[model samples]
Target chain A: MSEASTPTPQEDERIKETSALRQALIRPELGGIVGTIAVFTFFLLTAFNSGMFNAAGVLNWSTVSAQFMIIAVGACLLMIAGEFDLSVGSMIGFSGMSIALLSVTFSWPVWLAIIVTFAVCIAIGALNGFIVVRTGLPSFIVTLAFLFILRGFTIYLPQTLERKTIIGGVSDVAQGDWLAGLFGGKILGGLFTWMGNAGLIGVFERGTRAGDPVVDGIPMLIVWAIVLVIFGHVLLTKTKFGNWIFAAGGDAQAARYAGVPVNRVKILMFMFTAFCATVFATCQVMEFGSAGADRGLLKEFEAIIAVVIGGALLTGGYGSVLGAALGALIFGVVQQGLFFAGVESSLFRVFLGVILLFAVILNTYIRRLITGER
Target chain B: MTARSTHAPIIQMKDIQKHFGSVIALAGVSVDIFPGECHCLLGDNGAGKSTFIKTMSGVHKPTHGEIIFEGQPMNFEDPRDSIAAGIATVYQDLAMIPLMSVSRNFFMGNEPTKTVAGFPFYDKEYAARVTMEEMSRMGINLRGPDQAVGTLSGGERQTVAIARAVHFGAKVLILDEPTSALGVRQTSNVLATIDKVRKQDIAVVFITHNVRHAMAVGDRFTVLNRGKTLGTAQRGQITPEELQDLMAGGQELATLEGSLGGTV
Candidate 1:
């Protein structure tokens, strides 16, 4: 026993290295990592000469990715809990329209309008959850119903209130509002200005009246996306509630048999999905200073596609938040990479389809290899 | 009948009857499960065995019966209530999430949490350690607690379920046809696990149709035929052949076999 206990240092190191390799191979994010690297490398090879690696290029793609990631992360969680919310796209439009109408038309405080929008969105989210649970209906069908209902309202509400299909001048009301600065606008503006002055970053030709270089600051959307991803990763991997989400999604009957409150977990997932949609809507409305009924059209499918590429099973009970974030990054790179490479923007959909298919196949194959399933 | 124990049973059922609509699943069945003993319920298909166990496990309420648990009359509202009352049922399917890790499946709804900075998180390390220790105690050495339950062998999974129930402080472990789908080696492993659980002073209600299996580990046997108790006997009082005969409706089987032999 004493002789066996005193293993050689080389042997110990060998065992540790092999186990670490095995652990890496079995990780859920392995597919996402591969997909991200493959897509990034493809873009780097094809669009390098077109300024695709420049700061402006990075900002453009990152902004788009941040928007997708916000909802994708929520969709990832909800999917992990064994449900879907198709109305998330419409919820985004509806939330943005509500915030705009409340703050602009009613002359309410911007902060209060945001709060009211969140409350309304959350309530609708809860209703979706409640109906799905009580009626034992598939969330896909229920949320599909909400998808049309919300889209209809988003379009009809503005036309009814102001005889316009779009709500404009949202940024006008948001001006001078401290809360608006928190949710919208650029962060680290001073640092970017300094960088431009020091010739570290490229300055825009259109300078301000004060003659300061117009180097763009990091968008709050990107900040929120990063924060949400980290928060989601921690919640799913470190908390008891995370375990419940997995169990609920894996098998509701089995989870219930083990004493998990499956109903509550699913309901909260629905509410969280809605909350994420509202956050996306608020950021977009504040940034663009306008809201239209078609602002976030087809975003639900995009988010779901992002989640699928992230290695989450559509049937539920298995996923990774970091993987979803990486999936969003891949989307951003491809969509903008195509533009930089002079590929037709209409071909973006084709790229999205091919990437999604490849990701799903790779993910399934990897999972089978890990589980040793035939 | 061999001498019945004078000590009170952990769970006592009197005139238990269950009906699903017009179908009489179980009619007036009574049984007593004592701690530290392996009581085998032997029956054929449609013998009301599933309904009886479901009633005991709180999946179904008895239409006409009284359940006395730990010297107090009780009616469990659901499986959760019975589980809270220390009666754990490991069904044939085992009620385990296949995709989840062993430790996660072991804790499931009753996870051990550690609060840090006013936020509670799953104590994953603790769960893994306890799961490893408990599974090894049941003679099933797991590769790792993080291994998914679906990856485990059928016998190993059953042992894990039994160990999980014991870890959660189950006084009465009702196994519903646990060995029906297992091979010979797996069945023996499960029987060994039952013996281990019995030694730990937990009352084991082993439901099976296999007479040889019952004779191997059972301290007492109760035969159910067509929703009624055929009889109860101590292990020594009845041989395996006699138990098999009784399970097949002794007199009726004998007469039919004799007639067939005569015609041949």
Candidate 2:
């Protein structure tokens, strides 16, 4: 018999080294990386003279991206698990209004109100998952119905309680509350103040003492967004639960046959999506100190568009949290860059539509190359 | 071969009957799978082959019958219970996510995890090494354990599924129509893999409609027609042509062939 043709130890090492480069190229996040660089370059060329690359400009876009990333990361996870939570935008509105009405109107403690708001969001999320799994209906339709239901409630709640669609004075209730500081107020406030005093960075003048810079402390929204992205990336790539998510999304029946708890994984994913939406709402309510029924309008579609741009398949089972984070960054850059470039704000939507179309086509082409699909 | 004869059956289905409302999918079928043997369940389409195996694999509960596993009457509420009880069913579709890596697919549900930095993480390195080693034992030299399962040939995919079942402590491996979608070479490769599995002292219930393929690897054969068992035979006791005739409902095909003669 001929000698077996297995690779030698040295040959194996060489093969691994070469395959590493090939592997990196085929990663799902590669498209997002490319798109981020392209968008950053475009903005730098057109809007850099307007201080878009400076510390203050960077802070503005990063803060917006962070808020979007918070929801986009969750949306990315749900998409990877092969589902959608279209009610997320509505959940944000509903959750923000709930907190406002609870703390301001009912005179409840800010902490207690926050907890109740989360509980309500979690229940709504679980219901969405339960109905979808039990009836085997498309999550898109089920969550779409929730979108309207929650939006209607957001508008109706304040009208009933305060005789107006807007709920204000949340800041008054949040004042001196440590929980509010943790969720809403600026982080690194002292450090940024020191930087402003030392003339190292910009700070707010009118909102603070005289001679202060234009931008103050870092937004808590940015911190939460970054934390969520890292948490999501680890959960999707490292844990056994992450593997189950991929399996369930890829093929539910096959996942069940393989002994994966398909239904439970999906339900938990839905709950996580709602939880992220609540977190977004908390940041928004705390930042502005008020909430309207129109809060977070069209934000669900934005998160989904970001996920798709990150190279996640619309069908499911393939995506990256880091990619989704970058996708959110792209959205923030375009949204703010347009203002810096002196372009119409409405034109921002046109740019988003065009980017989403191109990103999806590029993502699909890359996925085909990686999966070797015809 | 004679030594295997003395071993108790790994799984025994006695008078298994499964029905779906007005349709009788399986009407009193029985099968016994012995260790260190490839027991081929031969039948045509709609002969209740899938229904019979689904009962054994715990995909469906037998409407009227008993499944004695390891000499104990077993009732599985889910496929998870069956897997834990050491029965692994590799369905015709293979029940595999194509985009996943070979190592991920190998330990899909039953993953090995190691705690690191106070958190549990999938032991990917160990999984990949084990998957590669196991597939090599079955004579499949994979390019890499991280390669997508979709990129593998039909035979390679089947081998991966079989190896996964074997690695997960499966005492009885039930393969459903594994070679039906494969080419001739891949079919032979799978048959050889079955032989390798049998030598490992695992009971394999290989279900297929192809008589010649069954004759190649099967040590014992069970014929089914009209959702009921026709008979069981030790490999050499039944000729391939006789097995084919029985699988096609005895003399019906022969009579049809006679009547259609001289058509040209």
Candidate 3:
């Protein structure tokens, strides 16, 4: 009688209580962490005595990694929102040319030119999003169209106005320009000098500026990369909107049923992608002292590859900013490490393809484990 | 019935009709839903059950008739308007992202936030705590709030959706085929969840074609056939077989039986 009258409990035997170790294994950042360590160890072993760890060599790869980081953060967020922006590379070229045309050719204040360039580029980004949302077209197609249009305009606009695909004299016009300094100038020079005097780092042995540290203050590009990574990570993991992004990418119909503004989230992510591209373009033009029509060729693919290696699903709905940043670091290290180890630089592409395949396989296995699907 | 009949209905559907061009989906169906009562809407496939719920939940505007909600004549422009008016519909799909954690799915669009140094954070601790409490209240003791919704049983997922609606102040809950895809044990758990929801004084419109499942927790049963409600009957006044016959069309079944001959 007591057995028949026993009350039913809510807890079921089917739901497995996960352990802390198992939970950590399921994190999206696991592959990135392992890959970063593996890459660093490989480089350190092969390129240790080739001055690859020197101050200048470290900066070389870090700057390149920062470029990849800027665009990867944007791509990572957009992928999580269930969309793609293929126009990012062309946008870089277009934004640089626009900044040059406004500041140098038109003789506008460098600050105004930079601000106007940002506004115009961001508007174009918004237009990309608008077309995608209003027409219900895939963002891949819409942004692919913009990629050609922007690249064409980038090449055509300079040739039509100045009879050249590359614009020069931008650095001369930008000298003493306060806005230009933010992009091009380095910081912490005094600290570097102090380090040089204290013999903490290599110094100029027999140059006009002797006893100067080989590496000076950090570049604004790296600063911007760090800032954007922190911002993107915080926004993607700690805010209510982050949940909406996951929902929108995971199942858009479900998100809408729950009252999420999916279109708005997707559009904003596209705009953010454009914004990141423009930041990269501005820093490139400032550092190089000119803008070329083919400046950012294939950078969009590089950013997407970095994100993929960082463990984002190509189908969208799952990823991490920290993982993407680590993926960028691996790219930077391997690209520069190849040259340091006396290997052909072109082999970098081969490495990217191989690592990308491995990461995707790892991510797929993790996905299956999480979902319990065959 | 004595106490419930005295209380005015929370939602009154007066002669509601819906049409898809030449096809009439719901034809002049009227049902009054009282608070704390389980109103089971029983109907066979293509019998206007979906259309009727869609019209009631603001997914479609009726071609004719008015919806009186809380003594106010209401015309919901869309699902959002109905949701804002305290009507939450958990459709068959449950509108849940399988990859997300149970807490995340519980508060998908309506996440609770707490200001931290002037910045609003997603208050995950509070959300997790509340999700655990609410799930247990609905008779589902989840392993943890972080368990992915995909890993949960169908009945557990339904409980999560229902608990979410209740926590969000839903006055009337419309569940479309909540137990259709569940196993027998899971179906019983869901029916028990319905009972728990009703005890909270929230009106539940349990839509299903299964007579046995409907009879488990349903206080009143309304059967529809060919775009019209045959009738509404109170508990103890109707049996499971009667409800099944009404859903399958009593006269139509009799004629079908006669056509089959009396041997078997």
lDDT per residue for candidate 1 within B1-264, as digits (tens), equals 233377779999999998899998888998988988999999888998889999999999999999999999998888899999999988778478777888999998888899999999889889999988877667665567988887666877888888888989999999988998999988988898899899888999999999888999999999998899987899789887677677777877668768877331
Q: Ranking under DockQ, best-scoring first?
A: 3, 2, 1
lDDT by residue (tens digit), candidate 3, B56-102: 99999999999999999999998989988999999777557877889
Per-residue error (Å), model 1, residue B212: 2.1
> How many residue pairs in model 2 have overlapping backbones?
3
Q: Give the root-mean-square deviation of each candidate in angstroms.
A: 4.3, 3.0, 2.3
lDDT of 2 by residue, B1-264 (tens): 677788898888999999999899888988888988999999999999988988998889999999999999999998899999999998877567887888888899988899998889999899989998887787776678887777667887888889888888899999999999999988998898899888999999999999889999999999989899998899789998788889989778777757878231
Each candidate: what lDDT? 0.87, 0.88, 0.89
Model 2 lDDT per residue over A1-374, tens place: 23544432122333234366666766778778988999899988888899888778989899889989999998999998999999999999999999999999999999999999999999999999999999999999999999999999999989988999889999988999988887887777677778888988765556546767556778889999989999999999888999998888888888898899999999999999999999999999998999899999999999999998888888898889999999999999889989999999999989889988988887777667556588
Clashing pairs in 1: none
lDDT for position A351 in model 3: 90
Q: Estimate TM-scores for all models.
A: 0.93, 0.95, 0.95
The residue ranges of model 1 lying beyond 4 angstroms of the native Cα positions read: A1-23, A209-214, B1-4, B248-264
Clashing pairs in 2: A203-A213, A203-A214, A203-A215
Q: In terms of TM-score, which candidate is stronger, 1 or 3?
A: 3
Best by DockQ: 3
Interface RMSD of 2: 3.8
The TM-score of chain B in candidate 1 is: 0.93
Fnat for each predicted structure, in order: 0.58, 0.51, 0.62
